[model samples]
Target: MTAQNEVTFRLTRCRRSVPRTRALAHAVLGEWGMSQDVLEVAELVLSELVTNALRVPVPSDRQVGVRIARPLEDGLLRLEVSDAGAGRPEVRAPGDEETGGRGLLLVEALAHRWGVEERAGGIGKTVWVELKAPDIVPEPVGREIAAAMVRPGYRLRARGEWRVVVSVRSEQCDAGYSAVVLGLDEGPALRVQAVEPLVVRQCEDVMSAAIQLEIAP
Candidate 1:
């Protein structure tokens, strides 16, 4: 695993408190100027995992906790919701016209990648989701395209699949800057190479022009 930014929050094992979890997510993402579309998706992922934990029986007075971290360089947002439930979660297949059974489905759809893992200390599970953020301004053109498709900073992959992770964070040196890092798991990683910076500026300009055209008459 690569080192990056990480934050954790605990949630009481109650369905009524799920909104509080969503509120926390909103505040964190808002600090980064994330689009509402991304925040809505993250909230839904939290709701699904937390709801599932509430349905299961937990040992003693244990509660649930949600961890939100974005690795500094990877430009990906990471979410983990953990509970002391005894069993593993299974994704259910939905039938036509079904109104529910879609929470995990939403996770798979909105997240660039997601999974479940046993918590490090003891029993229970952590359901995690990661989303790729647009890299900081002035990113090299080739890296920008690669980051978008490759999942900003994913450092590790599963045993078999070639997975990626990205992390993002704001830092201050002479001035403030946002860093995007990329990670590749279970395979060889690539090194960065230089490209004509002018080409990059042109690409960004083209995208900006296209957006303006869409809004124009």
Candidate 2:
């Protein structure tokens, strides 16, 4: 089933937090099966937001909060950065002589929509942006797992029809066998057991596989 997945980070106010936030965002969004294009844009957005938050002139001990979420139903990726310091972030027009101050401008250009919100209790504000997310892709099926070329986001023939792979899982069974569970684009879940030691290797951006797997009667 498709659901909203989110992760938040509390970072110390410092220059190092900028790169650290980018790395954390890459790992989280990568694990969520985001495409490379999405990953790149999200990392850039996170960098700008986190950098802006760190620049807020709050107390040294106060921390900056960063949140990354993908709401499957909305088909958009949401990014938020909250700072204990006051003032809303504004997009600026930088002249040719200006060396900086164009972060929010880049954000405004790339983000589908963005705005600021007052934090709870009115102690600070949260800057949030949303980007259009790619459609959800289903997981690899049983035959694909057995072939060891499990590619997510690729279509495969199953039950006499083509379906995308949304999620994939493999578990070692007793003896020399493994069990694989795949969630398809539709509501059906594919379960298979392979006796010949399975080695699942992931390949990104591959074409649809013509291999067919039959569902149990």
Candidate 3:
């Protein structure tokens, strides 16, 4: 699909919510049939945005937000994270002793192209990145949707608040599976269950390989 066929989403800014941010990208990319290389770049941009949002200070009335969109000129996936912080981000050289300051550097290297912009709200800035996407789309067939996704046949166990597992029955059908599986921190989560007719036309038209979703407790 062309960039015009792309999708966009926005979310609040919070450091601990990075996993939630990553999950948003995962679900959207999955719908688009994007590639791993593209997803990697997307994740890198997401990381930078999340870090910047967490590090910056916001106005008393404002919160951070993230926007993911695709520009129409080409099939470029763009990621933008905005916050109400006061200053623009400076591209800095990493220092040997410095533990921080390397996130943007990673974004600079991985994204096909990236930049920062002032928010329309006029309160903060949004750092963005754009990259090419893979051409193939998953037929959504031969793939099982579970309460949690794990590399098929593999079980995930946790001592904390997260719980779920996903398996890849067919790598060719479900390529570029996200290795980063996130468990819920609190509250109920949603899980997409495997369904018949992996592919479907719409709510009324059902396919043999469809994956159905259910609410999880």
Indicate which candidate wins on lDDT: 2
Please provide TM-scores, in order, for all candidate models, with all chains considered together: 0.57, 0.62, 0.56
Better of 2 and 3 by lDDT: 2
* Predicted candidate 2 versus true structure: per-residue lDDT over 111-174, tens digit per residue: 9999999998789999999988865333333333352244455555566555677776666656
How far residue 62's Cα lies from its native spot in candidate 3, in Å, is: 2.5
Total backbone collisions for each predicted model: 21, 6, 16
Q: What tens-digit string does per-residue lDDT give for candidate 1 at 38-101?
A: 7777778877878777777766478888887766567787888888777777677799889778
Ranking by lDDT: 2, 1, 3
Q: How far in Å is the alpha carbon of 16 misplaced in model 3?
A: 2.5
Which of candidates 1 and 2 is the stronger one according to lDDT?
A: 2
Superpose all Cα atoms of candidate 1 onto the true structure and report the RMSD in Å to 1 decimal.
16.6
- Per-candidate Cα lDDT values, in order, are 0.59, 0.74, 0.56
